[model samples]
Target: MVENEKDLKDLETEQSALSEEETSEQHDAPSEKNESSELEEALGKIASLEAKAEEYETKLLRVQADFENYKRRARMDAEAAQKYRAQSLVSEILPALDNFERALKVEAADEQTKSLLQGMEMVHRQLVSALKAEGVEEIETVGKPFDPQFHQAVMQAEEEGYEPNTVIEEFQKGYKLKDRVIRPSMVKVSQ
Candidate 1:
């Protein structure tokens, strides 16, 4: 009876040890699975944050480029404004100059009138000089090629000793403020 009891107790001890090992292995497997899942979740979050950061960086670059372009355009506009500052005043003075020129072309009736006309001519010359200094210039029309940019053709005629589309006469003068045409020349073009 004593021998049988000893064998039974040994068997129970072995069974209990095996069960404990199995339980430990089960716990380790689940823990490992949990750790792997947590690691995968952390990696996914990191990837999402990196993508967001890249998107923000791209937007920032675009805004910076847009701001730079705006600044360049504003600077160019200011320069253009400064360059053409006297355009309005020059436009106003041109008609008066034309009237003065027409008055100078009239024949004087007496010596007193001729002397007065001479003085007027000198004043006109001085005014022309002042305008020249301010970058005001007259457009050439007669005998040159007719250009719509610089000349307005009021009449077209077929004339001798002139090429087709050539300027034959200037009825009214044109003026330019720098490179820009303030008024186009009135002209007769040969067809």
Candidate 2:
């Protein structure tokens, strides 16, 4: 009976010890919960930062592409400006060229005048050469088929030994600046 009583006391002490341990664990649980909430907040911040980074990267790429397009457009505009720089000057000189052609067709009166005319002819040739070097060229007219792009038919005539719609005579010469026609040829077309 005394041994049984000692065993009961021992069991009571063990039960009390287990209850105290459970209370200590309950007291530590709030700190573990705080840690878990902080970890969740940190993970959410990381996700938000990653989304912002992706958005910024997309904006950066769009800005870069826009800059490239702007550069290309600017370059093309500069090239066009440079290419057409001499257009006005060339246009102004064409009428003078027509006058020179008319003067060359007239017969010289005497030897002195003939020499003067020859000098003028040389000057005209030099002018033509200079214009040619600047990308000006005479449009072909005589014997070629009349084309509205380069030739203007002033008169039509039935001519033998010539194909219909062929240019038989050029009243005024035509010229081109590069691939573009500056003036159309004034011509007589054989019907």
Best candidate according to TM-score: 2
lDDT of 1 by residue, 56-103 (tens): 576567557666776798899998888778799989998998999999
- Identify the leading candidate in terms of lDDT: 1
Query: Backbone collision count in every prediction?
Result: 0, 0
- lDDT of predicted model 1: 0.84
Clashing residue pairs in candidate 1, if any?
A: none
Report the alpha-carbon TM-score of model 1 versus the true structure: 0.69
TM-score of each: 0.69, 0.74
Prediction 2 global C-alpha lDDT? 0.83
In model 2, which range of ten residues has the least summed lDDT?
24-33
